[model samples]
Target chain A: MLFVPGNNPGMLLNADVYGADALILDLEDAVAPAEKDAARVLVRNALSACGYQGCEIIVRINPLGSGYTGEDISAIVPLRPDMLMPTKVSDAGAIREVSRMMAEAERESGLAEGTVGLLPLIETAAGVERAYEIAAADPRVKAIFLGAEDLSSDLQAIRSKPGGEIAYARGRMVMAARAAGVDVYDTPFTDVNDEEGLRQDAELARALGFTGKAVISPRHVEAVNQAFTPGEGEIRYAREVMDAIEEGKRLGRGAVSLRGKMIDKPIVDRALRVLETARALGLGGAEHE
Target chain B: MSKLVEGIAEAVRRSGLKDGMTVSFHHHLRNGDYVLNMVLEEAARQGIRGLTVQASSLFDAHLPLIDHMKSGVVTGLETDYMSGGIGREISRGVLGQPVIFRSHGGRPEAIESGRVHIDVAFIAAPAADPLGNANGVAGPAACGSLGYAMSDAKCADTVVLVTDHIEEYPLIPASIGEEDVDIVARVDSIGDPGGIVSGTTRITRDPVGLAIARYAAQVIEASGLCREGFSFQTGAGGASLAVTQYLKPIMKRLGVTGSFGLGGITGYMVDMLEEGYFRSLLDVQCFDLRAVQSIRDNPRHFEVSATRYAGPHAKSAAVDSLDVVVLGATEIDTDFNVNVHTDSNGYIIGGSGGHSDTAAGAKLAMIVAPLYRARLPIVVDRVLTRSTPGKTVDVLVTQRGIAVNPLRGDLEEKLRAFGLPVVDIHELKERAERVTGKPETVRPGGRVVARVEYRDGSIIDEIRSTEE
Candidate 1:
């Protein structure tokens, strides 16, 4: 839900729309190679001047060793982005290097150290294999994103319906991030014109335990958000299940029955997770309000 | 005897045009028109203060009118539509008198009924003869139909045909006959016909415009209006032209040939006619040169007057026979009341030329606009100026969704059956607000600036001057 084409001031000014969780003032992949410097300068000035209307601001500096990464970091670190997403990370060493550079730039610019967080992009086959190490590389690393298009190309596999080609990489990334105690986001569905395709892709990501899917278009934001968040009926049922268990516990009963089924600990835990996920998206907490 | 005159100044003098008289002009030349500016300048040179200029429509090209307005040469204004510089000054209350707004149909009805008296009507003819026989289809400034000026010619005390090209004493197939004219003034150029139609009149490539057009076509198909001998009209705009594009495929699929295409005809409508999607084009105004060529060369393209197009007083008009018409709006309220007269901040930018008239006449009056324009939700709590009443407007189609008026429950269900995003008008308003946020209500200061008149000649809404 973070998107930017760094060279476009107009696109950069296209803030406060689509209700993105975070906006990545993208300098990599989205920008032309010749305009990298222009993109960096534009992103730096935009960060200094623009507002994203309460969305967390981030930047995807060009990949380390792409040669644009240092200039991108040097130009942007002083602007103090909320987070930085590095494109095409193949290993932990790259993440550590970016974190070090961010630290040095932060100190030089007189900003509080470690103010910016980092999210390494897991694109290539090596990147997926080293997801755990990359996630655990630096304290600033809070989440990692999969680059499905690149991963499928690297695997020499044809991407199919419901994302069969990237399933293994998705599972590995999720498990690696979980083990390393960092959040994981799925890759964006490239076919923006196909809303159904986007919805199915987002549903698959949600079922596989990703928090949210990366979106390439503003139109995709709503579908991705809906797929990630629990529906109203699900939220209500989760609340009802929790209330029954709470009442049973308060009455000193060992069992709780709902709709003629005896609910046990695992079921209760699942309901709790559902409610927690909804509440995390700022949905079910309003019941108390 | 030949009715030729010396210049605009001589025509004004020979017509005995006085200081306080109401001089009229037609906007058939559209943005390319030079007659309005030239005549006003001559009238100003004549020291004719307190003169009222009754034009069919005003464009940015008439910005020079602002100078005359300031110099006290022109003290009053009346028109079916106004835009650009003149509209800005009028909205700012530069003129002491309140402007009078009439629908395209209403203006002719007024002129015919003696409600609006024209002292001297200036006709910008592309081609004219010494005897004052003129037509829009003949010269370099050819604009196809002089439908708007026909009423002024028939009713004005004195009519002058101003042209750059004067032919032999006889001008064949005259749109305005010589008997109605008192004088003919030849000029260097009537206007640049190329500027008459811009690239905007073509189908839009914007995804939003395409989506709305698709939904609009679906609405037409769902309403069962895309059948054999269906009569239709659409504005010359991105979404409107795109609707024509989408409808062509639908019409082809259904094998239904529409009866006629009406309103300001564009090249797309001409294409529809030639492709057998439609039978004929009843062009009251032509939006492009292709339409001009079609009107002149093709027997199927017939030029009709504004009264014959949508006049409520007419026993039978073309709009009355219309099965559907696609329009655009600046604002639409939950009640389905429309405002095309002002912007988000309530500054005047447009006036209803045929909006109310067609809405009143057509069986299915569909309004297509983006849900929000530049973050200003077009669906408002209430329109700033109620240009077209809610009851007359049948359906509202936005890029995001479609809403039918409560009066049309059948259309609501029909749209839903088409698998279109059919929502309540209020829900559509809320959806737009969810994206654009609710804009602050724009209630301009208390001074009334213009009166929005319905086709039946009743004041529907009063546009107040914006002091802020």
Candidate 2:
């Protein structure tokens, strides 16, 4: 995922060139408070006119509690982004409120109900504590994202390096999203210049079971992509595990041995999940053993 | 016509038997240099004693010249600097005289001032005719610039153009014109191009080097210098080139356009220039075939002489106008004193050619290298030799971390504010020593092989040879 400032027409026009699977045309945090209305209008026009070239475009609107939330919904709902992200979401009530507002906007614009999905950004200590409720709140909610910078600030914690801080929040968010049957994403790494740091953080996020990461800079996209993709070695191991499971089934056994390592149903199920994730991420089709 | 001399030996005899005569050579062939040894052998055979030898720079291949210096056939040596075997011999007082070191730009200045007049200048041409018109781009050992030899050919009263591949009467686009030539001769092979390009010139993949490169690029971007028209120059080294690679994607995303790349040209720089990332490439010496081909095909690739490249007095050298210059270091003390001449063992395996000149001139001078090499720590409590003054080197980038010169307090503040991974030079040295045990002290034998002179000709440090 890549974040493009809603007011940046140049970036919006060149979004496909970045090779991002999805783009979040951010209306909050990126824009000045005074220019919120203007940014909303620009984003609406960009979505209406510019061709996204097959990229999933998501419009990150202001929180429902903010003054500009009504205008943001009224303006962007008609344009129809793949998803509408609510920033600093704290609980189920906020998701429910945004869902209700989105439904009303859809009716007013004469668009179909449930057409736009919701992606809530959990940004504070309160939001992390209630991530499960937020993920389970609305059928429209598809993913929950953990924002480390805001959480760190709210908690008054110092993050010196990768894997030291934010590990607990990242882990909790992924677990909550998985339990609620929604996807989870890691927050943006503000240090655009630190490629190694970015790679290490992205790898950690991926290992912790996040679907993807939000990148502040286009330079971060390639590293994030490589981190998420399963290499040939993993694919081969997954195939071996599946083959062992099939042989065990033929022999009326619950487990089997592959290269002297015992393989069970859980291991076979995990291998299938990897193959599915790889296929969904467009890595390659799984070859049966 | 005078009796034709068969080899360099006969040519030296014909030039005249004399003591105290100044002879010069060019470093066009770089480390693969063989013409220096070939000529010195003849000088030794002719019993030419106490003759002063002036070359652009000494390389390991010219180690055989140590015999000539010890036998009194060579005495006063003047060049940019000496390295490897020649430097070791000179440090032992084998020549019985102090060696004079000059900058890449200062060599021309010294010759033009008549301070170091040349009696005979022997130029190794890759391809030349009998009348002495030569071209470096069309020979077996083609090293594409004779810029180092231009001053010698112009100032010397007797110029001998030696060629391995003799072409027709007129070689097109002659680097050294026929009017400056006094004699021409053909030989088997001038030198090997393979040896010239032997040093490490690729991007370093070591974790520390990559870390430093990343931080340096970050510093550049955070300083707001990632905008359009930014100029850069990285020397021929793996770590320096890694900076270029790291900067490429950032520049593309920022939509920043660079004006030009300046240095001893390499193929990597040529690719950047051709990719339209940079508007032009200012080449002083072509390091490989890609640069030579780029110079031949692309008009944007301009070749300038050494004086124009970094000479302090030149109307405004290319290096002086650079935004950044990435350099390599052999040793850097906590005080930031840099030594590109001697290793941790105090063995002279390198020179100070253009290292100091560029550091003092460029806007941001960064030295990127490993903290230790071959279990010898490069970041030390005190440098064994001081080639470039630490005050001029703005930043030291190692695999461990980056250390900005405290003199640039504003830069330090800005870098820290940007969340860069920065550490003090001393801390970096300590970390390096922890990984590779502290280097053993090299005992200095009381003889000086070469004197490292500051840009103003002040003796900063004297290079001593390793005791046998």
Question: Would you list the clashing residue pairs of candidate 1?
Answer: none
TM-score of the second chain, cand. 1: 0.98
DockQ winner among the candidates?
A: 1
Residue B228 of model 2: what lDDT? 90
* Candidate 1 segments whose C-alpha is farther than 4 A from its true place: A1-28, A31-289
Model 1 residue B384 distance off true place after TM-score fit, in angstroms: 0.8
lDDT, candidate 1, at B131:
87
- What is candidate 1's lDDT per residue for A84-148, written digit by digit as tens? 99988988889888989999999999988899899888999999999999999999998999998
Candidate 1: C-alpha RMSD after superposition: 11.6
| Candidate 2 lDDT by residue in tens digits, A30-77 | 999988988898888778765575688889988776788888888888
